[model samples]
Target: MDEIRAKKENKEYDWYVLFVKVGYENKVISQLQSYFNKKMILPFLPKLEIFHKYSNGYIEMEYKILFPGYVFVESNLNEMKFISMIKEFIHYYDAPLKLLKYGDSYEFAMREHEKSMLQSFCNIDFCIEASTGLIKGNKTIVLKGPLKGRESIIKKIDRSRRKAVINIDIMGKCVPITVGLDIPIKLP
Candidate 1:
């Protein structure tokens, strides 16, 4: 079974957000994977597909980070020693780490709604797929992708750019996330 699936079946870990240096997301993820077991620490960096237009009507597809400089980590916070070890390791690499806080506790975690939303974007292989939507008489309809049926959370939609922006509250701050989508289907 895959690591995420196994972790879901066990239900022993809680999701936490780690703030790292910009452009170092991949490096930190690699280091974390090497130092910890899949169950002990699972790092997730959600990505989306974007298209770059060329001069000759040729468009190139590329993957971009959905949330830059932040990585979601799943682990059991009860394991204080393990948490400390991770902190030390991150510090050793000269990467500053900030654990999200809720109220006065350091154990602030992702809400069920947020977790479900994120999980919907990820396939069984743990890859995040780009979402799709349609335009129907001034209304946006998500067709067959992760963003489907979750329109309530969408804050804005840039039809020209084919992107949807959603605001999520994380660690007491509202973070705006921009997700790329394919050209919308216009309904008659």
Candidate 2:
């Protein structure tokens, strides 16, 4: 348990992203957790809590994957072995486990800064909890949570849905991610 956490914090380990079926992010993480040693692989799927309204007219909170079809893992294992493990999973599930590649090399891993930004957004449990903030005029001020001090990245806010859309760099591409934002108050 702590061994994995320690290794993740180590600089030698690299972060890699795997593209799987959209709905299988959690399943793939679970399978990887069982197949690999905890210290060798730290699989994570960033999730966020959102409010859902049921047919009974009641609202409940639920967790949703922040980036569908992608799972990030920090590992110090050999690239060949990691590819083989992904191949094994592809064979077993009959679903593709495609590792994101850069340039012509399949071993290309995410840069340290990219990984650091992600780590800052997600907590130890790999979840981005709702950010509490206030809206005044045309500005959004995040008082707490992962989005604090990161208001510049916010492109739009939907108060009804309690979601904020922001763009972040992933695999050298700008990807828009929706995160939970609670604006409990508004000021003139």
In model 2, the worst 10-residue window by lDDT is 1-10
Query: Worst lDDT window (10 residues) for model 1?
Result: 1-10
Alpha carbon deviation, residue 97, candidate 1 (Å): 2.9
Which residue pairs show backbone clashes in model 2? none
Score every model by TM-score: 0.80, 0.85
Model 1's alpha-carbon lDDT is 0.71
Residue 75's C-alpha lDDT in candidate 2?
A: 78
Model 1, residue 155: C-alpha shift (Å): 2.7
So what's the TM-score on candidate 2? 0.85
Backbone clashes for every candidate come to 0, 0
Reference-based lDDT, each prediction? 0.71, 0.81
lDDT of 2 by residue, 50-154 (tens): 666677867667888888899988777777777777667667775677889775865458876777887789888878887889999878999998999999989
Model 1 over residues 1-188: C-alpha lDDT tens digits?
26555656556566777788889989889888887776677787867666556778676677777778988787754556656766777667766767665668655567666666566766754455667778787777887666788777778877666677877666666778777666557886
Off by over 4 Å in 2: 8-11, 53-59, 78-81, 84-93, 103-107
